[model samples]
Target: MAHLKAVQGSKAPATPPSRPLGLPGLAALALLLAGLGWLAGMVSLVQAALLLVGSGLGVVLYHAAFGFTSGWRRMIVERRGRGLRAQMLLLAVAVVLFFPPLASGTLFGHPVQGFVSPIGVSVVAGAFMFGLGMQLGGGCASGTLFTAGGGNARMVITLVFFIIGSVLATIHFDWWMSLPALAPVSLPETMGSANGIFLSLALFGVIALATLWLEKRRHGSVEASGGVLPSDRSRWLRGPWPLLLGALALALLNFATLALAGRPWGITSAFALWGAKGAAMIGFDPGSWAYWQDAGRAASLKEGIDHDVTSVMNIGIVLGAMVAASLAGRFAPNFRIPLRSVAAAVIGGLLLGYGARIAFGCNIGAYFSGIASGSLHGWVWMVFAFAGNMLGVRLRPFFFRAPYRPAVKGC
Candidate 1:
């Protein structure tokens, strides 16, 4: 042993900077999670891994579906090095657990849910609408939470408007739900959960190929946009593939969450849940909230949205995201809000909460999960929401135009 004085005089060993676990750690975690899943009868390790993979896929799809400038994209780009990778890994683990291989080609005792409906007028219309709203709103349903965490006051405002839009749509839910025009819809008899996963994966591949082709074709076009990829990548990682893989992993994780949890991917319901609770707290009868008594409906509206598990899971998402941000040293004080904007956020929250209730989903529910689950209604919601988003974007400037506005300064 070294002498006490010599030991004291020696410089303290340089401590390694604590960092988020990378891929290897993720693998170990997955192994542990596999045991937990087996004991719980939730999923096999393979299935859980698939779910994690599904979420990984979502991250990529999300980038493609919405332009890169969106809030979620910004968050991912900003935190490219740290918690971002961890998040992707977590999602991959989740996907494998949620959507495991079936026994004798079946998920559950019966066939997996869903039907084969080709791209119809409805899907086209819905996709178009969803794209538009997502663009204008500055974030989608899931986008709302992530962006909110990132301190984008714009997203905060957009979320409120989203709630308002959702509520407006909900008031007519009974009528919309009963629409005969939405008929001629067919849930696939052959496409159980596993089959659907295969189909989605195939489609994802096609989309990926098309995107690549488009990128190559557009290389010289103005649409290609100089400085499109993050600057750090140009200096360090130096390619889109890493980002692409990272994103795909996210999408796969989402799928996994659906499989193991027996629920679709989503985040908006938390806002709705909080909204409903808030209403009840303020003497508003939740029963009169249209979808308040619609637990079953909401549950089906999006996989896992209405479940207690989903609620807790979303809480996990928030905590997880915050932790990720903190780990990356990206956490910061939130932006300030003008009084009217504050009022708008409150109003937006109410609208977004109620609207999500009426619409049966938010961005994730209506758009992301909807597209993944093959729901026509999800598509429709996206379209109208786009219109709503555009309407919102235009109107936002009017409601809260003062420069350098301060945030309301509280959660």
Candidate 2:
């Protein structure tokens, strides 16, 4: 009742069709899930559950066309704050939910930790570079995976180099961490929950208002987000979910992750780990690197990749998006690549990899999860990254087509 009323009151963009699930896609997804469960079950039931959660994440991300890169780009270029505003809403919800448990220090007897980190040179530089890369590479960490899984050939290129760059950065990760940085500060830890939550909400509101003002000044009116199209059924299976709903779904999912996993959601660590494993295949001993020398990390390195929580979830996200795209009849692979776009993908991907590695996360790990965990470094990340995006938007035209077109065109 409440959700329906909110939908009626709000304005979001018209969504693409919610088609029925194709039989082949459904069968494949089921088989894949079964296989993943089998693999993870070899480890533990908890691992299997995380795989399912990861799949749900991928489905929600694909069905919603949720793009962190696009969201920031739209706000910067078009002054359309709808996407960015939705992010703010997501953060608002996440913080409110996350703070209570994080402050308490334990949930269901499991020790829980937030993503608090220091504000320093490494983070500042990494985040700014990541912002630039988001435009150049065409997606953030999550965006790259989902788009690639959904059969964007160019993103496959991005994913490959993203791994290479991540591996390369491991060489200098020690130096970056050694640089001067403020102590890790959590808003909830430094300030009581009452003060932290209220202050965070106020900041969100202020940012939202500022965007509205800028949008109005630039475009003469605040743009309307056309709501999603109504459907008799099949909305979940075939989706173009409204951005707001996507935001809410993500927030709730993150909270669930915290509860289930005993930590906030993270992504890029898996990328770096995957890259390291790939290096080992060719006789490169990334295991000797300082970064992997930690007792816990070394043990994880020895275990198969699937044994790692983030790696398993990352795999789930890839497969889940593929299934979602296929179910929607939107899974069309395009191999044709322009030299200019490929150039962008290479450069952007390297930046994404290195930037994320050095910064301790990408948009998903450092920015989204960071902020939601009440880390001051998360807020610091946004400021520098946004600055990077300011310049990246300019360079984009030289490297890629001016705008994106759907695979089928008018699909």
Candidate 3:
């Protein structure tokens, strides 16, 4: 909660001025380029491109301060809907860009697919845990990467624990999968593509309108919808981008990912892979686990991190955030974390990693990509995750002595 408060309190300048780039930022940029070159040379060009795409995502996320955790928290605690509305807009735009291509089963001559997973007990329980973890951890998967890249020392701790939890979950993954689950349901497949797209858009509109009503009822007027773009060139280069712009950029980038990768964007799988690889190094046989017995999972486990798309993208996000933070002159890492906060990070990180594994993905993988892909499971994940967030907000006080104050910024 303190980390979230810090993020909310630090508003980017309205008219950002040109400033000297930090040494760290320069160094990060150099590293990013080198990473890309290595990937291009050692792996396929597509992998390298994916890294670049991930970096672009990190930049957009950091500049906009786009966050699913803070957005939901603000909506729950403060009756603010700006962040939630931006999310709705993001989903709506993604539906438009993705539906037709997914229906056709290809993008730009490449086979493509959406993130459609089963709706079941695992998703319900996992999403709920993920929601609670977001509050305690102060960030979601994407949020953790960008904030950690921006030099938040506490988040690094969360990331480490997150990896540990992910690996731990794999040990129990077989049992979770054995639980009751519905068949994967794709709206575009069940309904017609046009019909599914329309339905999804209508749902987004309804949510956005609901947020508008709630905000208006709670506070005499609703907050301004952040649809207008700033005219300043400097602001674009060093941003606090409008939430809508951030939303649009994210949607477009996701579409790019689908085109290039033949699948939707995802984040947490890399955590599991990293953990499994680490386990293997210490004489643990993750490859023998039922979760990794699958051909694809087994192959990824054996191959190095550089060959893993999610891993490369995850790294790109961190480096990209570092570059952005340095450019913004905000890459200051504070290591003086409270003991209680560290405890929260550990518990929250564990919950997040385990939850994401069981649930089939995190906010990005399950909720965002899932819903955009017209999967019924995505909707189920949202409802349960929101319920978890409600409880997580209540649990926040137990972890922190600081008085609860609403964040001023949208996610």
Candidate 4:
């Protein structure tokens, strides 16, 4: 719908008014949110607020980094500007946050806890596939959740199929594990987490410089856009610094989450847990479900808090996103779903669920948190999923329409 905007001098332009939600709808939303908060044991109003705000901040951080990535992809590749320098700046921030001990002898809490070190072939292959998948899916795992919460019907479809793909992958986990792997590529024996971080920084620097130089020399040889949407410039403030700082804050929040929970950042595990719970309620043995088929290897859903953590965290994410959408006046209801698209969503969700199990994390857990923790496998999953995303994008026309037009030009 049209929104009114005041301009200089002329008669105030009339615009279509937004349909405010009715009292009943608002009441229902409040009740539902209240029930969710209760179930999650957010006993105090303050705790509830903190959870909502923290998770919302996390989502915002995610989008900010995403925005920067999209812009850099355009500017550097288009030879329009020095996007590489911008990326380097962000990476520099990541380095300081991830490895402060190099200069000060202390990283995030428990310096020993964050040191997973690097590996070889597994990481390389996983990174390639992960990148491809994320591109095709139109978003990474966490991205799917945020978009779906924002009422993007197409994202809902993509999420369904992501679950399907992940679940299917779980069904074949033995085969995947049997695939070639590098056991212990510890950095301590070679260079250590701090040293490895520096090495990575150096390598990224070389690549960034080369990319920018090539783009400038080639005169806009690479395509200006990829699977990502253009930016919403108005959504961005006067400068990009706020968004950049927001990302660093997100990384710090993630560190806190890890410290508090004694675990790493993740989202898909929550999805799987919810799926399992739903299955059990419907008379199915969740233990027999493909997604939970690997539970025997970890902790059984019946025996551990995995399902609880998943359910609570997933709800928090949805609620957090909902709150943000509402405050930003971006909330709406448009749940029209074509049969074919429904099928795609279900299939995709199932796959995404299973694959996350097999890979041990989705985008955030495996790719972001994992990489930040120095896990070689984290990098592997990222590369492979990205590859999967790339392939998934090609199949987009068959599954759903892409609707991510943003406000920034040439981004």
Candidate 5:
């Protein structure tokens, strides 16, 4: 679907085509939603709504190919800056929307809190691992979910190990918690909202300009390709959307998440819970881990996936991606795995999972939501994560002569 660039230079106006969605896929989605509803029991409406939102997330992510790892990698390795610039735009939009409500401390009567986490060793070490793991595993947290949903068989390997590593982190959470750390800090709290916004925007501008300059210097010029007249399906459903549009959608949806859940969007924590539950079912006693000592965390371990917000959202993302991929006729899953690639996936996935836990979040929770919510930890995470990516990119050649398409080349 993506390769079919609009008919270049043809004076004729082609009739826009509609992408027929796969009926079976649509049916599957319906059944999944029903399952979610049933799982929620008394809170069916709220649960269903979140599930639908999750599905929408999957669709947008899949159709747009909204990427984090790849976008950063393209800038780092290929000197392409479009994706990075788009991300800055996303942060800009998110910060503007998030800060105002978060500063006020309430939104429509629901208490709103920013994603404030401690500024310390765990974040630095974990984020560094996450960054490197993304390159090696072939996707960041969000990337892994969308790709796995879109029928990329190798990502399942990453997802499984990601869960294992996340669960393992809980066992070691006490030691990391013991590390020297500052209290959770937020720019909106320290600096006034207006001042924080100004500072954040200015930094974003600086980074955006730096990318633009670097791209021009290395590539000699930006991409020369002009937009081909888009087809109708490309506009909404079967799509390779403008990266900026993807970014904007993500920002708005994240804002919606705050409104609905009274918290920002998150991803990896669900993986940890899911893995722990699976372990508990097998009598592994993941519940005894210090991370589960918290009453809420301990209780959540006993509940089903439907009881977990992140788990439901993660399911929605996967199912949504599947529906989108199926509609786009791109839902092919090749299960055959190469030996070296398998090793990379295992190592990379473990790193991604464990790092996310240690860092207090994944790309979604820690970096994007964290920064947008004005948490200084987000900035710290990005720095170390990028360093990890630097190493991970260099190490890729050892595993595969070529990286997976869904990994870093795109989301």
Candidate 6:
């Protein structure tokens, strides 16, 4: 996670020099509570709860600096495997938490389901594009939201273009869906729940082991896996949390999402919805688009953004990060951006938006939630997306002067 700033081409310190309870943090906390109260009253208690979950995720993401883009970049460029290994550990834990409930077809008496998408040419191509885009945009979907929320001006630019790109993709969504595809495949259903869980853990173990081997070969030793344990309880609130703890927290939260929402955690669908709504405001008839013609999608469009679960969660993520950044005394926004970097943001955002739409999700929805749900497409997404990252890392030289390197060695 130390490499997060580096991957974003930022010059800011990885950790703020001071931790203070700022006025901005207090305001953010108050606003969060007010929003929760409003949602509970106007929307539903479930929506309010989801907003709270998203806020928690934002805190964890910002404080821990857990990011997929930087993790993959570090592995690809520096051969540092700590971030990649942390991801594998996260997946392993999630698989354990998810499989049993999914197999039973319910959690706490509510029907629950995983993000099982079809494996197809669209998924392959879209995931690769998304991976490449995240590298250029300097953040993945969740990374963009949290960083933008934390006051990274360049990422805000990336986020705007991401919305635009997602809207554009809907125009061509029908064409993409026409590509060769298979029915959704769930590993638990195919291989049995226990067997599927075992296979997933084994794969995660193999990947973690491979990263350890590669990192040791390159650096002559493996990097330590997590942050130093907090010296005091206060440090836990104002943190640089241990990476493994962040991983575990994410797994548990995602499981909570499944239990509460009846589906796993997701991110980019909200982007598309936002874009479509904007288009409608501008007198563009997005409702006619093939993507919006689906019964569920059409219903969402009619319901307005407040009624959309993903949109509310997405909003909470931004607000939550704002609070965390304020608490860390790191919520300074610098708008000065290089011409090339801005250009990269525009292009990268478009790619990320478009790719996520066609691919069914981004790192969170597809790769993380997907694999955790024991879906075959999730594994396929990982392969293509990593390939995209390889190409994206090479393209960085065009926009960035040099890859930012921190004083700290490991991610």
lDDT, candidate 5, 1-411, per-residue tens:
242111111121222344576764676578676767675675566666777778888877776678788878887788887777877888999999999889999988999998899999999999999999998898899889988888777889999999999998988999999999999989988887899999999999999889889999997888532233334545666565556567878898888888888889899999999888888778898877899999988888887777787888888899888887766666666666778888989999999999999999989999899999999999999989989988988898898866444432455
List runs of model 2 lying over 4 Å from the truth.
1-28, 226-232, 401-411
Question: lDDT per residue, candidate 2, 199-223, as tens digits?
Answer: 9999999999998998999989986
The TM-score values for the models, in the order shown, are 0.55, 0.91, 0.95, 0.67, 0.92, 0.95
Question: Which of the predicted structures, 2 or 5, would earn the higher TM-score when compared with the native?
Answer: 5
Candidate 5, position 306, lDDT = 78
lDDT of 1 at 213: 52
Better-scoring candidate (lDDT), 3 or 4: 3
Instruction: Pull out the clashing pairs in model 5.
Output: 138-407
- Local error of candidate 1 at residue 1 (angstroms): 50
If both were scored by TM-score, which would come out higher, candidate 2 or candidate 6? 6
301-381 in candidate 3: lDDT tens per residue? 989999988899899999998888777666777777778778888988998999999999999999999998999989998
Greater-lDDT candidate between 3 and 5: 3
lDDT of 5: 0.81
Of the candidates shown, which would achieve the greatest lDDT relative to the real structure?
Answer: 6
By lDDT, the better pick of 2 and 5 is 5
Which run of 10 residues does model 5 get worst, by summed lDDT?
A: 4-13
Order of candidate numbers by lDDT, starting with the best:
6, 3, 5, 2, 4, 1
All-Cα superposition RMSD per candidate: 11.9, 5.2, 2.4, 7.4, 4.3, 2.4
By how many angstroms RMSD does model 2 differ from the true structure?
5.2
Off by over 4 Å in 1: 1-137, 151-172, 178-180, 184-187, 190-242, 288-290, 293-307, 338-359, 376-411
